[model samples]
Target: MKSPILRLDTMKFTYISLLILVSPILFLSCKGKFNFSKQKAENEKIVVQYGEHFLTDRDLKLILPKDYTKEDSVNWVKTYIEEWVKKKAIVDKAEENIDELTLKEIENKIVEYRQDLLINAYNNYLIEKNIKDSVTDEELFQYYEKHKDSFPLVKEVVQFRAITVDKSEENQAERLFNSSKDEDFDEVMKMVLQAGNAYHDKDSIWYSPEYIAAQFPELNQNDQLSQLISRRKVKISDENTVTLIKILNLKPKGSTAPYEFVKPTIKNLLLNKRKLNLLSELQNQLYKEAINKNEIKINEN
Candidate 1:
């Protein structure tokens, strides 16, 4: 005859096996009735229980990643269960210790946050459905012209070409760098690339003076670096390397920023203005429709 303890252990094992076998069927049947409210049915299969709160296997499925490996799934489920227990325990302790009035205030704040989230989401959906995203170049230019005073240059900006080469090849590079011919510029660029030196040929893009100075430490250290801004061509040499810079354009600090530099900002500003106007129109249209349908009634008592 089996001992009483042995029989009890066998019964426990059987119970767990049955629970595992039926869990999927139970989950499917109860899936539609799964309510997120504080109230829970007494017969629900609880995975982790803390105080009055519990997490069901169904809840775990909802939050768990579908693509996890078998080992990863086991580890993740264990960690999630531990965290849920700890969090629920702490929250239960807080509710028990804190005053009712403070809890009510927290609930009110949660409600307000939900309201804001819903309104913002609805506004974004309406904007996406109704608004045309394209902004013309003419619109951008007009906006920049009107808002020129708003975007003063905080730092001096420059448009320039620069090349750095080994000291041994500086004489040949200097001749190429000073040449007005396009072929000479291309050859200089090829030489700079082959020797694995820094070169900047973005004549259309504006850069801060400090950015150019960084490539040539000698220029950065010079107190009269600003004086070099007026020069069309500049050459600086060190013990190991020589750098040649050709200034294409310069904008002084406090002057209006160039149109190309601020074009992206102007586009963003115009888009935002259009969005606001669309939202305002939506609000007015809704108000009028509500009044026409007798959905809104003003009460004076």
Candidate 2:
């Protein structure tokens, strides 16, 4: 979790220097190419600056995750620095060009936004500190069973092996896959890999019918993927490659989604529900206390 900003000195570059450092890279963009190791300076590296406001590398570190690679962090710094520059430039222009009353409106809006942000942050902090975030397996299962209708499958999902090989090896590949006596998917995959260039052989994972259709357009020749089952072995040929697909299982729409696949989703929903309940309880308790102390007054005419 080391900070990507190795040299704090380089962040002290002038506004013009930053432009010079970032602009030429637009002329040549490539993955793993963003590097700031060379931009060493005795002064701190200033990420973005307008007048006296300076956003440095350490400031950017607050928002960027600690696990980002040097390449990714450098790119993120460039993007954020650009946004910072544009925002400051526009806001400074608005303050200079806009009238006093309109400026006061903008000031009030900023205050409102800041207040909302603070409240939301504090709420989130309290939830993380006090709430039991983990949802047990039993809890998730019970929730899913009770609300199975809410998690109905909307898309046709299937477990299949898609083996794609060169056009010339189509017949041989299909013969091997169909003729395999092995029960294990790995064994089948090994057989396919010997002849095919690439494969999708995860028998455990279910994929959407749309995904299968896209991967092997031949699947859409007659009946759709929903109608196909594991016993079906399909051969699809294109101009360059041949695809051999075996549909192991098919689960049509309206069926309950697999519990394992939606565990994280269910956990989040339960956590949010808990937070809402706690918030309601807090509000109610405060209101009752306020009424007893004569702090709350209602004059309904």
Candidate 3:
């Protein structure tokens, strides 16, 4: 094959390039409305031509990121042209070398793939237009209750509150940390904030051991943390700082995940089930309508 010819109009190219650079947001915003085929037929310039195949400037414009610099854009266009030429050359060679039987098989497979894509797109459209997606909390809770065993924790999880303060204030912080009352916890949080100390009160959220270790590496250093059935206070002290943690709840690895944690999963499962049911109904309705209209004929042997 002859070397691919590059026929670029410098003034036109510069004008388009400047337009892309000046207002990238404008180009991006108009992308969905841009009619590339019509533009190509009317005024699109050929960036490179490989054998009988050619690549248009619009093709490069569509693929190029809006924020790329002039130097980056030039390099990118060069690379794109090289790759495009190689791909076209390979396709041309395949056309010339592939046997008739293989070509026919390839064509058949392409047709089958196109048909599957069309059917899936139509099915999705029907589902989006007709299906009502309104899942309730009650439904999610019911699903969780029935299928709790299927959603077990792979690792131990804990819900806890922790406070980090100076060693000098450990005694007072420990007292506040050990307290079960919300008011006492709030007072400690206020004190910690005033003193510019660290405090966490995510008792409602479940965290893995790794996450806990990351928050308080001192606790995991000696592997002092263990599975607790009830609330337990843990204190760790370094040279200057002291961390006090209260393990509010602990769920073992084999235990079912908390309802709050797996609620989203339950909702998704229910939604998928509803979608399948809707699709099945649509299929049956279409078949029945076709039969009634005598569009589908059954010949008895």
Candidate 4:
């Protein structure tokens, strides 16, 4: 039976999934405008808005439609225009105060933005052209075999109680060990596993070795904790307080993952590799052209 919290969590997940599924379709219906092409000046273009300071488009659709009504769009446009005007006013004021170097810096920024936009446009085109739905199960399996160690299967974690005490508690611990001899070893272990005043269950008493090693670095070894205590017994303040540990349970690490376990992940990795390969080929072709045409120049200075 699922807990109420779990059920609510599941419902929350379902709600999110439904929202994700319907969001794009709803956005498309309300605001049909989308920008697949990179921003570039065309010979023929529709002028949505033009002002003394700035220009914007009616095609600049709102990303957050759920928060605003249709009347809000009008207000948004007005606010946007006002903001642009304010920004331009500040820029114009700054321009009047700028030196030759500042103007040169601004020109350099414009060139960088142009180059960035062009690269993004080219990458988008290459992605559309080269990437395809050709990755099969066999392909994924082969890829996984090649890169099996990249993603190891989630290992099963073991829980065990460990108590470290000084030499002063030796007598108390010896007495307890002797008294608990007749009792079931497991039961004795469960009983002794107490934090503060309350006793935690056997399952809850201990933690995985990995977790323990991280939290309590004093435990000494990665593989075994028992070796650390036996070597050197430190002094304890109270003789009555016994250092006791319990090995609640052992959960061995899981084996290597099968091909089916990582098929989807391997498929994605293979697709990325193909995309990179395509990009490299295009880059080489462009490099050759630049060299042939003497478009690229090298300056030692």
Candidate 5:
């Protein structure tokens, strides 16, 4: 009942309409499936918060030191996020005229710095792994006893030899005070002062003045001679011989240094030394492994 041209036109219109309806369906069919499981897993990650800033587990994994525990990672990430926010705030306030090239250069430098930090973090992990609270109280006591002379008081004393000059060059033994200078000896003395009077032997230096006075009780007791040689006050013993007194150093009285006084400091020192030893061992092991696997290459220039 319709004309041929009208029928053809109607059929063409219908075909176009069908395409318009079907295109989206076809496109969607070719697309990959939606991964709700992956999305859920990503969403379930732990996130750290600091004020308005937030950092997820994934973010922490990037910045966290190797071998950090879950709690440590969380704490560290919170700090990191806060710091990052502060930096971002500062950057936002910075002038916008900074060239894009400079920004890229800074970004590159930041990447390098992060890489260096990663290496340091791994080394710190090695150290932490080896750290031990191994030094016992008994061991400490024994160490103190064996090295009792070792733990000198803050005011150190020394037993030293000195050339006491007298006035008469003939009898350099006992006379008036000598003014002549021994140039070589003076030079050596100057060097000693320059070198901070560095002691050659630890054993030679005594920590207790009482112990020293005990050794030379007679000389120490003799008020006349005590004042003559390195005593607190100088006194003229006789008219003919002037006493030239020289004190090597002062040693305060020694006692058992309170355990509380040294315990924390000793613990930290011992711990750090142990950790350093462990780090050295790890570094050696790493080097050996790298060499075995041809990981290290030295370029000759």
Candidate 6:
């Protein structure tokens, strides 16, 4: 689940999304010089002012995601300003109701949280700057061998090519399919494509039987597809259309996925593991170096 702060921001952006849909022409007209950060703090103009607490144009612009168009810039700033106003209102009311002692405690907690946030952000920045990103094929293979059980193929999947067409085109498709040979598979596909409403040529991409069924909505389940996958070509004719399914490749359930198929997943796992290890290593080294230089002190109880 997203944090409340993040969810609020997302909801705030949704208004902008809807507004963009409502009137693209008007939204475009509303667009102006939206680079809020270009202005100095002294020159910064207020977009939302809630009595004592105010939000600046720079603040809204910084929070907006990159690649925002001129219309997006205007809408997001307006959305964020409205959100900030609501938040400030609640905060002001809460402050009035709370006792000074409780408010002081809350302020202390916020200070601590702010410090921790900055420190952690800087730590991540340093770790990212120093960490190695690319994992080698050798590294992946070694990790996979050691942790094979951790990566299980839970679902039945297959690789296949299929074509679907209206019943009228079924005879011509079947004739073209039969006339084409394996070596001329590409050319055969081109011919098959024209005769079908939808088609997928044989490719390296893998798909679950459930996914294939979901994609077509003609096949019942994975088992039905699995049974037909080994055959050269299976044609099913219905009231509306005829569908042809051909198995390019198949990976049975419980079978370990190929290294290439899982390379990306393995790479991300390795990267995270390396990052954690590096953090531990750097923290220990820094602590020891700090003690040696008398930069950090501990008072005995």
For 1-301, candidate 2 gives per-residue lDDT tens digits of 4554443333334334545675442223435634443343455455554453555555765667667865566666677777766776677788899999999998899999999898678778779887765567899899999987788888657777777777776665566676656554455466557764778868778778777778766667767453455446666677988767887777777888877656778999998998888778877988899999999778998
For candidate 6, the TM-score is 0.59
Encode model 4's per-residue lDDT on 97-135: one tens digit a residue: 999898899989999999989987887787776676768
lDDT tens string, model 1, 1-301?
4433333234444434443443332223443444455655575446544445656555655665666654454456556656665676678789899999999999999999999899789888876786556689998898888889999999889998989999999999999988989999999888999999988888999888788777666776665356568776778887998888888888989999999988988888887888888878888999999999999877998
Model 6 C-alpha lDDT per residue in residues 165-247, reported as the tens digit of each score:
66776676666655546655555466556764678764577777777778766566445654575564567677997778876
- Predicted candidate 3 versus true structure: per-residue lDDT over 92-179, tens digit per residue: 7998999999999999999999998987887778667765457888888988888899999998788888888888887887787788
Tens digits of per-residue lDDT, candidate 5, 265-301, equal: 6677667777777767877998999999999999999
CA displacement after TM-score superposition, residue 250 of candidate 6 (Å): 3.0
Checking candidate 6 for backbone clashes, the offending pairs are none
lDDT for model 2 comes to 0.69
Which model scores highest in lDDT? 1
lDDT of each: 0.74, 0.69, 0.71, 0.51, 0.48, 0.66
Clashes of 4: 0
TM-score of each: 0.64, 0.51, 0.72, 0.45, 0.33, 0.59
Rank the models by lDDT, top first: 1, 3, 2, 6, 4, 5
Ranked by TM-score, top first: 3, 1, 6, 2, 4, 5
Each candidate: RMSD:
9.8, 11.3, 9.2, 15.9, 25.9, 10.8
Candidate with the larger TM-score of 1 and 2: 1
lDDT, residue 43, candidate 4: 38
Assess the local accuracy of residue 35 in candidate 4 as a C-alpha lDDT between 0 and 100: 42
